[model samples]
Target chain A: MTCEDLDRRLSEGARAADLAAEPAVATHLARCPECARLMAWLLRGIGDVRVDSARASEIARTGLKPVRSLPPARTLIMSLAAIVAGVAGLHVVTMGADGWPLLSGSQAIVFAAFLAVTLALLAPAWLSSLRPGARQRVHPVAAVLLLAAGFPALAALLFPVRLAEGLAAEGVRCVAGGAMAAAMASGLLFLVTRRGYPLDWGRTGALLGAIGGLAAVAALQVSCPRHEAVHLALWHGLALILPVLAGFLAGRRAG
Target chain B: MASPEQDAVPPRTGAAGAREALDAELLRLMPRYQDADRAAADALVLTAGPVLARYFYSLTGDTRLVEDLVQECWLRIHRARQSYRRGEPVLPWLMAIARHTRVDQYRRWKRSSGRETGIDGLVRQPSSDPRPGIENSLQAREVVAVLHRLPDSQREVLTMMKTNDMSVEEVALATGVSQAAVKQKAFRAYQAIRKALGVSRREENER
Candidate 1:
C-alpha cells in the first residue's frame, strides 16, 4: 500500500483501538522509519499521559464519605405524588361554594385530556433526569412552545363564554395565587431531582415549571368561582408562563 | 518488510486486557461504594482514578486543574451513585459527570473573571524540564498541542476515543450524539492531526 493509504488505515486503527494497530499495519511500520515514527508518536502520546498515583489515591480516599441519593424514578414518582397531594389539599381548603362543578361535565373531559398531554410531555424530562443515559425525544424548547400554545387553545375550547362584565380587576389575585402554587410545586420538584445530574437544566426546569403550572390550574379550577372564558384564558391559562420563564432562567444557571 | 525486532510499537493487548479487568473490578465496587463501604470506595477510586484523571487532563491540559477536576468528578460520582443502573458501563457515566463538572467549573471561572477561556486556554504547555525519557514527553506534548488546535467537538471526541479508550458508542452516549456523528468527529480529528504532523515533518525536512 502507498504510505498515504497505510497512514490513513493506521490512524483509523489507532483511534478505534488506542494501542493495538492491525497486524498488517504493524508489519508495514517495521520496514518504514517514517511510519514507525508516526506510530511511535501516536502510541506514546496516548499511553504516557499518566496521573500522579499518590494524588489519585488521596482523592479516592474521600470517596469513603457517605453520600445519600434516591433513585431518579423514585424521586420523580414522589415529586408527582407530592404535587398531586399539594393541589388536592389546596382544593379542599379553598374550593368555592359551587364545589367542583368543573369535575363532572365537558370541563372535566377537557381537563383530563390536557392533563394527559402535560404528563406525556413531562415524562421524558423526568425519566432523563433519573436515568443517566435516557434520551428525551423532544427538545426542551419545542416542549415549552407546545405547552405555551396548547394551554390557551385547550382553555379556549373548554370555556367559550365571554361574560359582558369584565373581571380584569380579579386578574391580579388569580395570577398571584397561581404563581404561588406553581412556586411551591416547583420547589418540591427541584429538591427531589437535585441528586440526579440533569444534562439539560432548562429542559428539566421547563418540565418542572409546566408540572407546577398544571397543578396550580387544577387547584384553581376548584377554588376560583369565575367560569368566564376571558378570565380563565387571561389569568389561569397564562399562569404557566411565569413558572416556565423562571424555570428556564433557573435551569440555565443550575445546568 | 524489516524484522519484527525492529518494530517500534510494542504489543498493546496487555494494556487493553488490564483495562477491562479494572473495569470489571470497578463495576463490582460501585454498589459497595454506594452503600458507604469505605474499603470498596477506596478500591473503586484507586482503580478508576488514573483513567478519570487522564480523561480530565485531556479536556484541560493543566495538571493542577486536572487534579482538582478529578476530585470534583469523584464527588459528583458519589452524589449520583444511587442513580447508576447495575450492569451498565461505568466509564461513560463517570465521563458524563466529569464533563458536567468541567463545564460548570469553566462557567464559574468565566463569570468570576469575565474572561473568555475556551478549551484552548485549558491546554497548558507540558513541563519543559527533561526527566528520564524526554523524547516520549515531547511526543506526548506535541500530540496534546496539536489536539488543542482542533474544534471543541472534534477534540472532545478524539480525547474520549484516544485518551479514555472509549468506543464510538460510549463517546456518543457520553456526548449525547449519534454513533455516526462520533465516528465522523473522530475521523475529522484524525485527519487534522495527520495534516498537522505532515506539515511539521515537511518543515523539519526543509530545515
Candidate 2:
C-alpha cells in the first residue's frame, strides 16, 4: 500500500480499536507494515493499570446500600415550613379584615385549636416521621404534596380576624407580625430538629430575638401605615425580608 | 507495623472480601427482585463489576475516588435498569451514567465551593503515574498535550480512543460519526500529535 493508504489504514486501526471490531481487523492489519508499527506504538501507549479488582468489587457491592441516596429530612422540613409560612401569612391578612381578635381570652383558645390543626397539617416532616419507615425514604412527590397541603392549612389557622381598635389604626401590621412570628418559630424548630435535637434552647432564644426585631419593624410600619402604593409595596417587601432573614440566621446558627 | 508478608496477604484477603461483599449486595438486590431478574442482576454484577471499575479509572483522574464513584454509578444503573434495553451495549450505557456522575460531581463541587476542580480529576486518573516502559503511555501523554491544542471535538475523540480503548466503529457509534469520519478524525489526532512532538516526515512515514 502507498504511504497515504497505509496512514489511512493505521487511522482505521485506531478507530477500529476504539470500537472493539470483530475478526481483529487482522486480515487488513497483516498486509499493512505501517499500520502494524502504529499498532505496536499504540499498544505500548495503553499501559497496564494495576487495579485492585477485589477492592473495586468491594466498593461496588457496598454501593447497593440505598440509605445514603435518600434525600435529607432537612430539605423536606424547609419545604414544608415555606408552604406553612406563606399560607399562615395569607390567613392572618384575611383575618384582620374579617375582625377575629386572636388576642382576646376565649377567642385565643379557639384560635389555638385551629393553630394545632394547622401545625399538624403544615409540619409534614413531623407527620412523615410518624409513618412506619417514613423517616427512612420519603419520596420527593409526597414531600412536595405534604408541603402544599400544610401551608394553606397553617395560614387558615393563624388568620386573626379581630384586632384591637389601636392595632387597626396601625393597619395589618399586627397580623403580619403575628404571621412572621409563627413562621420564625416553625423555621427555627425545623432547623433545630434537622440538627439532631428536638430544639436547642439557645438557638430558639436567638431566633426569638431576631423575630423580636422583625416584630418591631412590623410595629413601626403599623404606627405609620403607608398610604401610597409604592410605600405599601416597600412595606410588603420588608415584611417578606424580615422573617426570611430571621429564619436564615436561626437555621444557620442551629446547624 | 505489619510485615511484608502481612501486606502481601491483603490481596488474598481482598478476594474473600469481594465474595463477602458480593453476598451482602446480593442480599440487598435479591429482595428487590424476583426469579430471573435477580439471577440476571447477580450475573451482570459479577461479570461487569471489574470492567466497570477499570472504565471508571480510565474516565476519571482521582484513583482514590474511583472505588466510591464507580460503586455509586452502578447503584444508579441498577436502580434505572427497568429502562435499559436488553442486548444493548451495556458498557456504553454504564459509561454514560459514569460520565454523568462525574459531571454531577464537578457541578456539585463547583456550585458548593465556587471553583473548577479540573478535567483531570473528572476523568484521567492521577493515583498511579504513567507506568515506566510503556512507550504507548508516553505517546498517549504526548497525544493528550497535542489534543489540547486542537478543538474540543478532536480532543473528545482522542480521549475516547485512548482512555476507553474503543474501536473506530465504537467511537463512531458513541460520537454518531461514520467509520470513515472516525478514521479521518483519528488521522488528524495523530497529525496533531506528530506536529506537536516535532517528528520528522521520514520518522512519521516509518511509524
Candidate 3:
C-alpha cells in the first residue's frame, strides 16, 4: 500500500497482528522496517506519563473547613418562645366576628375553588426556578402567604374593628394591620435567610394567597371605614402579602 | 530509507525503571525540602514550565509566544487551586490544567491575533539557517501535529500515556474507562495522525 493508504489503516485501528494477517500489509511491513519500529515506539510511548501523587495530597490539605454545630439550647428555647407569642397574638384577632357576618355555605366553597385554580397556574413556575445548590425545599412564597392570611384574622379577635371619625380610636384596625405587617416581614426574612433553599412553590403560593384572600374577606366585613382593624387585617394584609409572595415565587421558579 | 534505520530497535521495557527513578526523585525531593516543600512546589512548577513551553513551541513553532503562554498556564493553576480535587496525582492534574489553559490561550489568540500561527508548522523541522522567523523556529518545535489533529479523547489518552508513564490499564482506571477502550481510542488517534501525514505504519509491529 502507498504511504497515505498505510496511514489510513494505522489511524483506523489496524493492529500489527491484523496487518500481518492481511497479505498486502504483511508484505509492506516486511519491505519497510521503519513503520514497524514506529508502531513499537508509539506503544511504548503511551506508558510513560504519570501524575505526581503528592500534588493531590497537597490540594486536599488546603481546602476543607470544619463544619460548625448548631446553636445552644437556651438560645433555641428563647427563639421558639418569641415565635409562639407572635403566632398567638395573630390567632386571637381572627376568632372575633364582631359585626361582620361569617360566610356560611356557598361563599366559602367559591373561595376555595378560586384559590385552587390560582395555585395550579403559579405553582409550576415557582418550583422550577429553584437554584441547584439550595439546601431547603420549603418555598418562601407559601410561607409568606400563610402568615399574611393567618396573622390579621387572629389580631381581629383581640382588637375588633371600629369605624371612627378620624385616625384616633381606630384601635382594632391598627392592631390587625400591625399583625399582618409583622407576619409579612417574618415571611420575607425566612425567605431571605434561606436564600439557597429550594422553594416549594405550590405550598408557598397557596399559603400566601390564602392569607391575602382571608384579609380581603375581613376587610369587607369592616365596611369602607377609615379606621377598622378588621378592614386593615383583610385588605391591607392581603394586598401587601400576596403580591410580594407572588413576585418572589415567580422570580425564583420562572427560570 | 531513513525509516528502516529508526525502526531497527524494538520498544524496551524501561517503564519499570523510569517509574522507579521518578519515585526516587520525588522521595528525595520531599524529605530534603520538607520544611520548604511549598517552595519546592514552586520550584517544581518553575522547572516544568519550560518543558511545556518548549512543547508548545514545538507544536506552534512560535518562539516569541511560547514563554508568555507557559506563564499564563502557571497563573491559571494558581488561580484554580480551589476547584481542583485533592488527593489525586498532582502531575496529571497539573498537566491537565496546563493543557486546558494552553487550549484556552490558543483559542483567545486565534480570535484576537487572527491566523498568524498556523497548525501546519507544528511538524515541520526548524530551519538550520535560523535568522529568527516563525519558519526558522520550527526545528525546535515538538512535532505534536499528529496529536493536535487527533480527537480530544485520543490526544488526552496519548498525553497520559506519554507524559505520565501510565499503562493503558492505569489510564483507563484514572480516566474511568476500560483498558480495552483506551487502547482502542489510542489506536484510532495514532491512525488519524498517520493518515493525515501520509506516513506508512509499517514499523508499528516492531514492538
Candidate that scores best on lDDT = 1
**Where does model 3 exceed 4 Å of error?**
A1-34, A40-255, B1-15, B23-38, B54-61, B81-87, B113-153, B169-182, B196-207
The candidate that achieves the highest DockQ relative to the unseen native structure: 1
Q: What is the lDDT of residue A209 in candidate 1?
A: 86
Query: Compared with the real two-chain complex, what DockQ does model 1 have?
Result: 0.30
lDDT of 3 by residue, B9-86 (tens): 664345546555554454443332223346554555544544455444434434445545566655554443432222
Clashing residue pairs, candidate 1? none
Worst 10 residues of 1 chain A by lDDT: A11-20
Where model 2 places Cα greater than 4 Å from the true spot, the runs are A1-7, A10-39, A45-255, B1-46, B59-61, B116-156, B162-165, B172-184, B196-207
After superposition of all CA atoms, the RMSD between model 1 and the true structure is: 6.9
Cα shift from native, residue A191, model 1 (Å): 3.3
Residue A163, model 1, lDDT: 62
Judged by DockQ cut-offs, is candidate 3 incorrect, acceptable, medium or high?
incorrect
The sequence of per-residue lDDT tens digits that candidate 1 reaches over residues B1-207 is: 988788776645554666577678978987777777877876877788777766766666666676678777776776677767666778777877877788778777778878886755655665443433212355556667667767888888888777776777777778766776777777676667767667778888999
Would you estimate the TM-scores of all the predictions? 0.77, 0.37, 0.37
TM-score of 2: 0.37
C-alpha displacement of A177 in model 3, angstroms?
Answer: 23
